[model samples]
Target: MMYRNPAILTRLALLVPLGLVTGAPAAAQEAVSVEIVPGAVSLAVGEEVTLTARVLDAEGNAVDAQVLFFPSFADGRSGSARQSIDVDRATGRIRAVKGGEFLISAIVATARNLRGEAMVSVAFPPVDRIDVTPLGGSTYVGVATRHRATLLDTAEDERDGEIRWSTSDGGVATVDRFGILTAHAPGSVVLRAEAEGISADVAYEIRENPAARLTDEILWRQKEQFSDGVGYSWIDSLKEMAEGEIGDGQLARAAARFPTNTPLTKEAYLYRSIFASHFPGEPAVRCAPEGPSIACSTPAAIAWDPAFAGMADPSGRAVQGVHAHSY
Candidate 1:
């Protein structure tokens, strides 16, 4: 039963067993009597509460009583599901059926002697929902494909970042303590995020990157830096091409700014395979002129079959280039 001070029941769960006699001492005994210390009551749907029972002789010494709780949901609510658990000798747990009133009860027996029953009402909480953000694209092979999600209250208000994210795809991806995802291999993964009892989920794919260190370095160096009186964005250092928006002269100077930055390389045929997997209507060319090997695609047109979409970067325009097809 629910109690005003819960610790008193917790202590009782542990101590109730101390008074029972087992094995050698009980062979010659008469029938033991059992009675539930806590009594019965009504509860709101989905409420959780605790129960405890005691077995004793007519003289009032605690005896060994085996407790067994039966399902007795309210008349029409019998269809609701309930689960009960024993935490210790004197205490057990019970959850009420959902969405309606519930009648909960418990029983115990000392040897073959049946004990009395007891219960109390608990109110079940409400249903809730959550929304998860996309953790798309491959982060070099063997890393988590993660999605960020925000929690929502029952009223649909966004709760602060008090979220717990998990996954069902242990073989494909693993989640870290801070909700960062790591791909375990080249395959699909499903991720889940939850708060309180509410939950939501999404799925994505991941693969290994043969050029992981190099890719990481490029992504890392792109962070803002002050090379001189002029501050540079890491993208300003890559190969540049003229877009409809930016002129070739400006693109050339931006490309010149970081002549020292290394070019991203194709490590394996697998790289081509992944790039080719882009969806239809993706941009095919970005860093260069509309060419054969663009990574992204423009929305209004579909160009080459192998080319998905053009990838745009801050780097200046030079000669047009293509990223190879995915393996």
Candidate 2:
């Protein structure tokens, strides 16, 4: 799109192909028009192109005038549009940073109204490889984990594309379109991610959950779970009693009392106070189990059950027969 404002500049600037410019006399220096040479061009990523601006008189004679060049997206988009191409105002040298089409404008600095524009199109290279992290690893049945895949060009430049995920043995483990893998049974399987005809694979082995196995080994007595190992109502009874034993004000000041891993519940406060009476040392307090956990499971095992991530209790009742796996 080009327009001339005769009201702003007496002379007109015409954008045209590169051509010989005849010398203009001092009087002819009042350009009738200005133009940018090479009206259009196309280049690949990392390529460079230079544009020339000429202020011409009525007889197509070159005139003297300071010209500046600016680059903008042809489609009028912003952000990455500015990142796609770079231009030197004084030299009109443009470098393609990414694939996109842009318009290069050459304006007469003195007149401000006389200007010319050129079109430039940049091409992007193809994806040459796919890289997946944890190329090979092991997980447990009933456990889930997320994997990531990145696309790269031959030059190792990162590229953007949609990835399709799949699993070789669905019975053992399954992968979703977003690369989340869920272990269904015990076995070995291959996880694959594909994009632009390029694919990457990750080998995995699903084993029986050791937490579930440990329960089977030590489940001789009734309810052999933490917090409820003695009886299902034991912890509940203690919680009910603590609600009366500890006042609201005391629980509010639990942080000042225990300092480390401050008790958040009446049941927790009751237990902490009792433990402090027996072993009243900062080191012993610090040794108390802390961090996120579920059903006596380790912090890492919490990943297996998303619901466990925010759990404060280490009781085994939520996951009745499960415990943290040593492996």
Candidate 3:
């Protein structure tokens, strides 16, 4: 919709078009008046608004002519030279480049000259501040947490803008574009959310996860169960039990014994302990009792020789009714 101001109409009456004489000869010529539709405008920076100028003869009849639009700052600086406003010389369409008030003129030159000017106020919605939710918190490795970023404009209105998320140390934690943070290792990292030129930062810490560690070790052992490698099918079952079936205290106890540096030996021991604790005296290995002593064999030892049995005790006595197995 177009809006015109009565005060601006009163000012336009005195300001005649340049090169048009106010003498009797010029008065005899058709008097043309330029009416700037929508005498006032308001828009945000980088926004576009259309301004139309109506050229009328002395009889108020529409007259078609070549119209040129000129834009200038309120301080009398050339807006075109400063690149603050873009004018489609062909059409009177105007686009604001920055935030400021500008005076736009629509001028026409022919046998008679006509001119009209209007005011345009371009504003910029500045970001006053940025806020990040869950300010600072802790999470476990292999866990994910959702974060939120809010932008407050100068008007104190909340605006949802496109945000870019980043982490100070990607090795410790990573954040997606949506601000979902995934912890990768045990460390602290600064999570940053940026929109426009404003940014907000929050500290996030990742703690070691015993269950995840144990599960990773068990998976590694499972991958080694190929070809002639020692089979560790029980490790998979132990992982499921530790995750949900077993009690937290029991799982924690088993996880405490997990090796940090040398994983293979420690993982094997941990699995065996879990298996033994759950099913005690369940004959982990089969043995043959020969006279007063028992001959025990494991899957690995049996592969070497069918008649092979376990070694004797340190006291040089026959291992009586005792069986042993190797993982």
TM-score of each model, paired residue for residue:
0.27, 0.53, 0.33
Model 3, residue 112: C-alpha shift (Å): 35
What's the residue-level lDDT of 159 in candidate 1?
52
**Rank by lDDT (best first):** 2, 3, 1
Local accuracy of candidate 2 as per-residue lDDT tens digits, 1-327: 789678544432332222223354333357767688788999988889899999898789898889999888889876545577888989999998877689988999988888889999987778899999867788998998888999998656688899999999899999888889999999999999999999999999889998776655476544446656666577668767999999999999988987798887787788888999999989998887765566567778889866666665655656633544211
Best lDDT among the predictions, by candidate number: 2
Global lDDT scores for all candidate models: 0.49, 0.81, 0.66
Which candidate number maximizes TM-score? Answer: 2
Candidate 1 stretches greater than 4 Å from native: 1-127, 135-138, 144-147, 160-162, 210-327
Question: Per-residue lDDT of 247-301 in model 1, one digit per residue for the tens?
Answer: 5454445434323321222221222224336621224313323322322334333
Residue-wise C-alpha lDDT for candidate 3, range 1-327, written one tens digit per residue: 889998987666656555343444544435378888899999886789888988778898777776778788877753252376777765889887766678888888663347888899878568878899989788889988899899987756576689999999999999998899999999999999999899999997789987865665576442221221333344445445545654555544543543231112223345456555765553541231121111223334434533334431111112322222232
Candidate 3 worst ten-residue window by lDDT: 285-294
**Selected candidate, larger lDDT, 1 vs 2:** 2
State residue 165's C-alpha deviation in candidate 3, in Å.
Answer: 1.4
- C-alpha RMSD by candidate, in order: 24.5, 14.3, 23.8
